[model samples]
Target: MTAGRTLFVTWYDSNHRSIIPVGRLVHHGGAEGDLFEFRYIQGALEAMERGFQPFIAFPDLCKVYRSSSLFPFFANRVMPTTRPDYLAYLEVLGLDPTEADSVDILARSGGRRETDRIEVVPAPVKDETGGYTTRFLLRGVRYIPGAEDRIARLRFGERLFWMLDAQNESNPSAVALRSADKCLLGYIPDYLVTDIAKLLEHHVSMNVFAEKVNLPPAPLHHRVLCRLEARWPDGFLPFQGEQFQPVGPLTAPPTHADHALQ
Candidate 1:
């Protein structure tokens, strides 16, 4: 469904050592209640060519799967509400358990597990201002200057900003996040760089805020949660390229593959 609640299924390509968005999972809400569908995108084909085996649950490369309930594979990723630390976990993610559903939790927490390379990444939603807004954990925190101390000092809802690092030796298009006085925080995830750069090149009104900062002992990737808001430039579509499309029609490509991390 073409709703704002879309999330991309990203797979960390072990062979290539890079992240690839392999599918689209959309929540199509209606009077009938929750309806969800998942379809492999072009990235899935790319992953297969690069040696990524399909998951045990969804083995087909081109079949469209639908369910009235959240698929078990993803449902299992969220911590159960019955867990003793569930509430505190939500607090760490800056979510209200009363209002946050499974999808919401997955979006903020990234549905990450050490056993798997899969991750759930929320797609940017178009806001009322005709722009888009999304939230993500600040990446590369361990490499930032005084990162933990600066993150510890950040208050709730603190406004953060970014500057283009055209000189970055690793990635010329890297977007560096910083505070008001301009101390480096970290960069947005690499998967988002091109789209973010487009918004900047087109002069979109960009604003980033510190939604929550999980200081110390927390993993570096989860050190800070920031929200970015920007106008969607005309003719701009994120994640709609050929690489995001299926290589062929939905003909059901081997739906019974064994789960292999290799």
Candidate 2:
């Protein structure tokens, strides 16, 4: 048995390689095991207008609530019981066998030129001394100052700047990072607020830095990847598992049946 984990719902536009965050799923320690919640974002609603309906009941904007026991959106990500089935799924996703994280599958799925779609996968949460690190593939690169030039100089495992924007009207828990020269970069995803915001409110020592910098002409949104490292007085427990099992196949179909927009 291990600590529970957090999963994020993201919609990928393969034509542009852009990712739109839709909802989240948090599976914590409880007798119920996996309590699922799904929320629809503004982007999801817009997608719906364009004839995209990923769920039988399209989630309301900015609202959060529990989902059904056998939600296919989550069930498809859980590792299949049989080795052949697991390998076959990976092959369909064009993923390496070792790359088992459902989030990775979701990310890769965006690169295809077919249709934009939604996926549920694990969020990146790493535990360190008295704190933990959360990573984001920085968005809005075009807004940063000479972002392309600066990113060219950044090496692997380099540190960048992180600052919180409490006044951000859209989301109060917004955390932003900048370049070494103090130019604005991008923000931490909205899904991280509940946990990361608590750490900030307690005056926990948090460090923000650059983990990886992918230069252009890569997709504008995913060019620079950043990380937030928070240090608390008490150590935090990170979620353990390469794959998340919320619901098994016995209770649901093999694929995300609800997300298949007609």
Please give the TM-score that candidate 2 achieves against the real structure. Answer: 0.53
Per-structure clash totals for the candidates = 1, 2
Q: Output the lDDT of residue 49, model 2.
A: 50
Per-candidate RMSD vs. true structure?
5.0, 9.7
| Tens-digit per-residue lDDT, 103-185, candidate 1 | 99998888999998889888776778877888889987887768777878999899998888888866677788988877888
Which regions of candidate 2 are displaced past 4 Å?
Answer: 1-5, 10-54, 57-130, 166-169, 232-262
> Residue-wise lDDT of candidate 2 within 1-262, one digit each (tens)?
1254556566755454444455545443344343444555455554455555556553444434454252565555455536566665454444577845543554433322223365554565556453576656665567657766767777767667767788875556676767677867677555455556567667777676666665554556556666677764355433222212222122332122233221
lDDT of 2: 0.53
**lDDT score at residue 161, model 2, on the 0-100 scale:** 71
Best by lDDT: 1
TM per candidate: 0.85, 0.53
Quote the lDDT for 146 in model 2: 72
Error of 2 at 68 (Å): 16
